[model samples]
Target: MSIKGKVAVVTGSAQGIGRGIALRLAQDGADICLVDMQIEKLQGVAEEIRKLGRKACAFQCDVTNRSQVFEAVDYAEKELGGFDIIVNNAGICITKPLEKISEEECERIFKINVFGVLWGIQAAAAKLKANKKKGKIISARSIAGHTAWAMLGMYSSTKFAVRGLTQAAAQELAPFGINVNSYCPGIVDTNMWTEIDHGCAPEKGVATGETWKASVAGIALGRAEKPEDVAAFVSYLAGPDSDYMTGQSVLIDGGIVYN
Candidate 1:
């Protein structure tokens, strides 16, 4: 599982799951390229990684902007000498029932969660192919991706698209020794979940904590998930041991979703 000399480009890495992944990879000896629209927080994460004795750089990237994503990837590869992994962890969600889902919301979710992933795969895969290097491309999917969730129609739809894209990329890139996969998480105790809890409260006529408690009840592990929990799984996917596993949406959901 050693990746001492590797470089990883992680999008949406200013906070939460993306930030955790970048720090974990850096702790594991990989140089990190942190990408996010929030340059201040992104640079903070880079500093944290640098403090861990790893080479790290922060790039201001809006994943929805294809050119920005490519430019960030190119800059990382150039600065780090090569790219070994790219984690497409930039995504968003809105709390709206099917009846309330709007075209604008649908388009925005797809742009970040789906199109963003595709753009990262295309950019990173091309770089690896041109260098004849085998690498890993990991993305963020969700439990809603596998099974539709009530009040999250648009988000679920976009994540489902992510699952398909990851698989297709895996199949196409296997010949070139590139691995593509995604981490599907559930009830992670992140800011995103906090937003979800608050957003669903009014709709469900419940207290804020009620929504979070109900979600945690379904997790057989009997606890909320952590960002580090997802990061540990991503670390595995980025390492040599997981080289044989590709095109798979591996769930790290504390048993909320079973395969």
Candidate 2:
């Protein structure tokens, strides 16, 4: 719970869920390092953190590009005093019918979602090793990764990969005292959903808040997730209390999966 002097790097922290995570961590006393492709937006999030009186910096990074990722992580370490926690929050989702899914689309999704997580892990592991501290590696995954969904085949596959990577990395890094885990959120009110909503097939019904609300009505808890909701969990993992939890995926799905 006490992370007063700790440092944390959150990928894709410019907005939505990632932004929520960054702000939560900053408020909890972690020196925040934000990574995102959009420099302008990243700057805004950085400014917000600074207003909270916390040290915050934003790095423009394309996680799919290994060289850029390496440089960004190094820059983060050098400029922000190296990070004590790595949040692999950068990811992408593409919805298409199985037959209509293109090879290019699949690769792009994997590059960002799966490979991106790998890049963050590789870069942060080195930083943690150099600092001689047992650090934490956390990522955002979706419930779609755990359960199969129609028309979300490509995204589901990538999510599954994220879950596997987290488990394997946990095993490999446990000896070094580094912890790795994944956060699985379900049907959250995120920009991703907004985009999907706007493009929903007419047969699926009009894209409205009521329709979206009904979609998740099957959940036992009866609610959609909020970015801040997930951010709170990210804070716990980055702090000391979750030091014992690693290489596991925590679901923030509002009991939808269980329901």
Q: What are the clashing pairs of model 2?
A: none
For residue 82, what is the lDDT in candidate 2? 57
lDDT for residue 143 in candidate 1, whole number 0-100? 94
lDDT of each: 0.93, 0.85
Strongest candidate by TM-score: 1
The sequence of per-residue lDDT tens digits that candidate 2 reaches over residues 146-249 is 88777678888888899899999999999889999999888878888765555454436665564466667866677778999899888888888998998888
Q: After superposition, how far is residue 185 of candidate 1 from its true place, in Å?
A: 0.8
User: Residues 149-184, candidate 1, lDDT per residue (tens digit)?
Assistant: 998888899999998999899999999999999999
Model 2 misplaced stretches (Cα beyond 4 Å): 202-211
Candidate 1 minimal-lDDT segment of 10 residues = 100-109
Task: Let me know the TM-score candidate 1 reaches against the reference structure.
Answer: 0.98
